[model samples]
Target: MPLSNNKSPAATDIYTISRLNREVRTVLEEVFPTVWVRGEISNLAKPASGHLYFSLKDSSAQVRCAMFKNRQSSLRFEPENGMQIVARANVGLYEGRGEYQLIIQSLEPAGAGALQLAFEALKQKLAAEGLFDEDHKKLFPLFPKNIGIITSATGAAVRDILSILKRRYPAANVIIYPTLVQGEGAGIEIANAIKRAERRKECDVFILARGGGSIEDLWAFNEEVVARTIFDITTPLVSGVGHEIDFTIADFVADQRAATPSAAAELISPDSAEVLIKLKHREEQLIRTQKQTLHNYQSRVELLSKRVPHPQQRLIELIQRTDEYSMRLKHQVEKQISNKKMAMTEIAGKINELNPAHKITQQIEKVNVLEIQFKKSITRSLEKAQDEVSSLSQLLNTVSPISTLERGYAIVTEPKTNKIVTNTKHLKSGDQLRIRLASSEIDSTVDSIHEK
Candidate 1:
């Protein structure tokens, strides 16, 4: 069915052919401001003015398009009549020809656009199945002995990786498995190299590397074959496909992704210089500890040598000590004899002193002295106590509430709670209160209120 332009003749306005076409073009442009169109190029024409005029068409439909020189100049590949492309363009109408057309903003080969879509679809598919999950990824060997590198044989990527590995860690053995990083069979070659490396099982870690390029150039890393190969490998794989901003399916599937080939080498290898410095530090510490140990042993040996006295000297000291003891014994014996005579006289005196009458007299004298001292103490204590009591009584009477009332003041309290009534705000003229004077408490009602 075809749309008809039959407006009723009796309607107020009739459209001319040009006006009708203009109206249609406006409607078309408004309906589709911008769109993405995919088709093969046909009727392509370049009039030497640097502008491109072509018809984008599929088997069923075709639309005229014009790409300005500014836009065409930036295209990565030349446009040919039969080449399929995807274009981002604005819908427009050529008022002169009364034809609707596309004003192409940008376009790329269908292959590249399709690759982008495929990349996303495959990425999602792999992620959903947990192929890109961290749990599936292997841990990088802490100290890798052999490192396997899969990259182009003659590309700068391999050179950069080797240079970095050499600088960072010279001891690790490196194995290079050269393969095409891009082109038709690149993905398969890379995948096969990975499987081969795993079969060998010589390398502790593998690096899949490539230099920076357009997404199409680095598309091998985005291939499903390479991603799955990386995921299936037991040895840890690090993807270094391009610059930091570029990411590929291999990056997610690999154990880790480095921003560049150099970064991948640095990531897996320990710095030889730093390791050497650490070892030197440890050696210095061991030397210091050994030196301290030897010094302690030497000091101990010196002290023992001083403490171990010669046999002759030890004997001399023992003889001197015996002579001193002999002299002390003689003096002690003489002293004992004298002491015995004196003790005889003293015992005779003590026997007389043990007489009961004499002892009773001495005890009576002691009792008399103690009795006098006790009487004095008691009298002094009583006097001190009497003085304290008199002072406290005076102090108490001076500050007593009764004393305060006797000085012509009264304490007023609310009879309801027996609380002091210092504020009149809570009282009314007829409220009951108790007024306590010096000697009596009187019940009263609040009189006519007053305030100062």
Candidate 2:
């Protein structure tokens, strides 16, 4: 073959196959940088490096492609051979292998043939917004008073939820907020039912449920509208859609996710048998505790009763103490009586030793003699006092005013103050005076007075 569009080179112009392949690689690099190519994958290889090596082909032709670890890590789902894919890649040649290939940067499932792409797209979008995050999830209540159901009124999901709710907690009221479970308007209808249940205050919690179905059949529950409605509802939400392996948008947005409708009911309500068993066990424990406590108190009372003395024995001790006190008192009285008698006898002996009658006669004789002497002395004294008194009386009479008057002496008195005037200082000229005689006084005016 010619290297250029000329005749084959002789010796110097001919290049080896490797050199030719290198020329082809250089040309391909110049022709394409990165491009989009659609094909089905085959012979896929994933090694320890996490790089993907595969061949992309149509029925007519095939090309070698490689996705490095960085590009492979970006894929949301695992890729395999037979997966119809659209790859964005740079065209290049492997120098070592001397082969032409594409170095892939990214790949996606071809929409015209993809089955799970719609679901993946929705999942990615919702996940980006944290609708599927555990932090936003509400814990299922340990006890639910009423369970509101948003599902088809005639669907199997409703019957399953009701049966489980009744079996677990018969007291819980299960209200149905019926809605269309499938078809065009199903998402809006389900959202509306949730809102209505909240507005009506019909139930403490809600469950969005449906039986198993194809992904397309269950798409209503997976709609963003329904998921958002569950998130915004004030009542707690529990989602039970399809089977255990099935997941939906509503599951991410709900407060609780259950694999089946019956499981959702069981998650929200308490188990009847378990509760009853606990209650009965507690009751038995309480009764046993009360009986033991009563026995303890009764034993203490009986023990205290044994320690208490009898009333009759206590009375006997008190009576003995009283009798001893009485005997002591009687002895004290007799001793006092004997001591008094001895004292009286000693006084009588003293009286007898004193010769009372003879002494009394002597005392009487002395008193009589003293009385006679006193009378004689008193008589003589009386006679002498009488004589002296008569003489004194005569003397006093001589000094008396009446005697003085009888002797021709008169007492002069002042008429205003009734004072006797004996000296000239007591009398004033022109002062009225009275001359007191034995029986009468004559008034006079002090004309003159002489100094003593």
Candidate 3:
């Protein structure tokens, strides 16, 4: 393509496509400067280069736009197809394609600020992924040894946090990880500061804080990179961003959320005065217990002392009692011997009065006298017995069977039965018999029967 000189008919200026497009781009940029274009986004394309290419169209027509990587980095909300947006860009022509398009510098949703929508969108995303889950949250150390503050060193947030922490617990070690909390690339700097703190491993816990501001001023904390970093760190984190009502993605993802920077300090630091008071109370209790134990031991020692006896005194008392018992036992033995001696003497006197030799003499004399009397009586009794015997003999002679036998009568008896055979009827022939005639006896057998 050639550019013709309108003033000189014979003069001609030839141009290449690149040169022509360059001139057009310059002209459009110079004329348009920076303008706000409001329309519905369509055909949105985001490539790996981090640039956005889209068309902004209304009811009748549309314009092509290109947002470069540097400019796209400034976008808060993601541009989507069919979303109504207002882009602040400069009119320009694409040098390579020679296509007319707007060079977008900034973009926002039609109804809401870019930062707010971005904050809400990221908060929702991370929440859905359980980044803000209670299970993922870490508990703040009761007493953090080293506390890292990720904020601008000169910002009021650091000052407030330091003041409160020092006042509550002066022993706490505080470290400041200085970073930009607002403006361009603040999010990157903030996220990098967090990483550096993690790598250093210096702090027991982290306090991500900043002064109160609008959403835009507090935009770094709301960035996805910063939020994800807070969620991923092993160290416990407390987010104190903006005012009490203001909240960011960092707040949702951090382990604890404080209303302000001072509040975060209060939450992390323990009160030294209260702890000291409790320690003093415990010390007093221990002292009182030890005193009570000592008193009890002393009382036991006193009670035991009364029950123990003096060794020498107790031995002397036992020796005196033993002597008294020995004397009593000796006296009882002497008295028993004296009484026994008196009883023996009385028995000896009685024995002498009835002497055994004298009694024997008297008994012999009486025996002689009785012997004479016994002889005389014996003589009389002998005479009398003789007379009686004679009379009895005469009577026996008259009645005795032997006397009849002696008078020429015979007695017959069966030899086997020794029965008398008084009648001839009782005698049997051939039976053996004995016949007694006075002093003689005859043995015979019956030969004849006699009845008389």
Candidate 4:
């Protein structure tokens, strides 16, 4: 239906819907150029257009507020439903709906976002100083000998870090540099603690940490002194200043940054279980190498004994050398097995010591499995080595001339000269001769000589 602007004879100034909405918007804008409205947010809608449309209301009344993408960029915190927020906005009337609304220019948490601005400022300053450079960031040691914790003495952050460090790496020595993690003078104390730890050079890594809190509560970590101190430390520092969502100036300057205190502990320590597996692998590799070396030695000995022509004395020396090598190989394998076993025992003991009650049973079962596997591997290696040694001994015996004596052979020699009489020309009748058999020697006088 086409609506006409029908005006009474006395009412010459008739308004259309568009003209009315526009006039109302101009008047509203003029009346409230910039107003600070504090209310609880509701019906929050963030569309793909990057505009936020939400209802800011009190118990009795509500006004629709629209924060465009450009204006929302100035928000210090994301506006969420049920969030108590204060917004600076201009009052206007929407022409399309003829609805009254507020166009939000900026937003912040009601009376609680100044610290965030300060945090951003300090972060930028430190970053510009190269404190946050990747080159300046040191990788946390895989296995720190002494793990230093800098946090409140009685806070949950300390307890969490200690618990995690104990569970993951019980062998590491923990040194707590207890200090205030919040409030006045906390930043100075934190900086001093870092300096003390650095001067003493006792800890391999440090955790600068605190529990999650409000921005103001965690402001100490955003202090310039804390950032500078963290940047100057040679020992790597991990900042777990707050919860995963929270970050501070110290986080930017620290060598490593973790989401929480427990995470910081994880960054600095090696898991005992993983270390055990790696040791097992190393032991197996050593066994394989030793086995291969022994096999090669055995093969070389067998080849030389069967094919190489040498004086009897020289062959005897070669056999003695092969025996020495076999003995050395046996000793080496034994030594390696002993060392690996001892190391595994020590590591397992450490793991057992700190195993949580809930996990102890599982840990014990795993250790048992590993132990059984280790023993089986050792047994196989020993058996294989013994078999090779036995084979080598048999081969040595088979090539020996003494073995021929057992086959009904005798050697005739001059008794006085102890020289073998290979030919009859070397002996005469009535000459004393010695006959050597497999088990005994006999004395004989040669009355007659047989040529062949």
- Among residues 3 or more apart in sequence or in different chains, the pairs in candidate 2 whose N, CA or C atoms overlap within 3 Å are none
My TM-score estimates for the predictions, one after another, are 0.49, 0.49, 0.46, 0.60
Highest TM-score scorer? 4
Model 3: pairs clashing at backbone N, Cα or C within 3 Å: none
Rank all candidate structures by their lDDT, best first, as comma-separated numbers: 4, 1, 3, 2
Residues 71-96 of candidate 4: C-alpha lDDT, one tens digit per residue: 76656577889998877789999899
- Over all chains combined, what TM-score does candidate 1 have? 0.49
Identify the runs in model 2 with alpha carbons over 4 angstroms from their true place: 1-128, 133-135, 312-452
Please give the lDDT score at residue 291 for candidate 3.
41
The model with the greatest lDDT is: 4
Better of 3 and 4 by lDDT: 4
Compared with the true structure, all predictions reach lDDT values of: 0.74, 0.69, 0.72, 0.77
Clashes of 4: 0
| Residue-by-residue lDDT tens digits, candidate 2, 1-452 | 52677656788667788887888888998899778899999999988988889999999999999989877665755788799887779999987888789999878778622434566687799889887787877666555566788899999999988888766676666789889988899989988888889899877788889999866678888777887787777778889999998888888888888999888888887775565455346434543543454345334432332333334444333334333433443344345334534543443444323333333344346534643553354345335434433443432322211122454768888877776677677557898888988668798887887775
Worst 10 residues of 2 by lDDT: 395-404
Ten-residue region with minimum lDDT total, candidate 4: 354-363
